[model samples]
Target: MAEEELQLEDGSKKKKLFIIIIAVVVLLVGGGAAYYFLMGSDEAVSEEMTEQGADNDSDESLTSTTVKTGTALYVAMPRPFVFNVPGSTRDRIVEIKAQLMIRGSDNEEKAKMHVPLIEGALLRIFSTANADDLATEAGKLAIRESALKEVQIALSEITGQKVVEEVLFTGFVMQ
Candidate 1:
């Protein structure tokens, strides 16, 4: 009778232990499923937000357009001018100073129209001056300023634009 009672007690304890283990496993599986669902939704929300941000950036870039502008270029050089010297000896080396003022136009035709007058003005200066006067700094500055004014006027007439503001020394050589 005593052995029979002990066996019944041991069997009941084993049954209860198995039931507890099963309940713990089921709870763990349920928790894992819930976590996966929550993380998946978060990822989907982030992806949608990123895509919308990209679309907004593209639209903003399209709305802002760039405007094209024309540039003024430096004029070319190496043109020679000969001046008449009053007291110049045959072998005497004379210095002549001159500057060319040029303006660029948005229109090619306008630039072309001003080229002749610019060249002509420079040519006339060369025809009148001697080397001794040009050697001085003051003379050179005066010549440059005058040339610039003439070029600006000619360009204004040709291109109808503020052709030139100043003359630049394209080339300066003592010899």
Candidate 2:
């Protein structure tokens, strides 16, 4: 009876030891899977993000011309240190120093409008600029866009036509 009891006790201890080893192996495999999920996929996610971003960017611009046979005209924008709004007390534009040229079409009608309306449109652009805009790259681009729009409007108003498509900046010097 004593021998049988001792044998049973030994078998129970072996089973418990086996259970402990299995638990340790399970824990190790679970930890390995967690690490793989958290750290191993970072590179793949970054590559996918970069590829998607590239696809979303704008296509390159293709240069083209639409003018029927005729002489092209280029007009210089008025050079100004700064232009003030007629009624506003604060001088919004610190420096308005840039030259924009307008390309003309076959009919001089569209081209001729640039000479007369450019001054007023330029005045509007200068009065729109501020000191900070004259200092930064983003600001400069903003000012360029503002001036371009003004030029386009002036062209449209004068010629009763969509004369200028792009306002070319021939020169720009701001302090």
lDDT of 1 by residue, 1-175 (tens): 9999999999999999999999999999999999999988999999998887666556633221121134544444345444444435432234334343333444334544556677776656555555565678886677676665556556656655544434566455544
Listed in order, each prediction's TM-score against the native is 0.43, 0.44
Go through the candidates in order and give each one's C-alpha lDDT: 0.57, 0.59
Q: By lDDT, who's the top model here?
A: 2
Q: What C-alpha lDDT, on a 0 to 100 scale, does residue 40 get in candidate 2? A: 78
- Model 2 CA lDDT for position 172: 54
Task: Check candidate 1 and list the clashing pairs.
Answer: none
Least lDDT summed over 10 consecutive residues: which range in candidate 1?
A: 60-69
Q: Quick one: RMSD of model 1?
A: 22.8
Looking at candidate 2, the ten consecutive residues that score lowest on lDDT are: 60-69
TM-score of candidate 2 versus the correct structure, residues matched by position:
0.44
lDDT at 140, model 2: 70
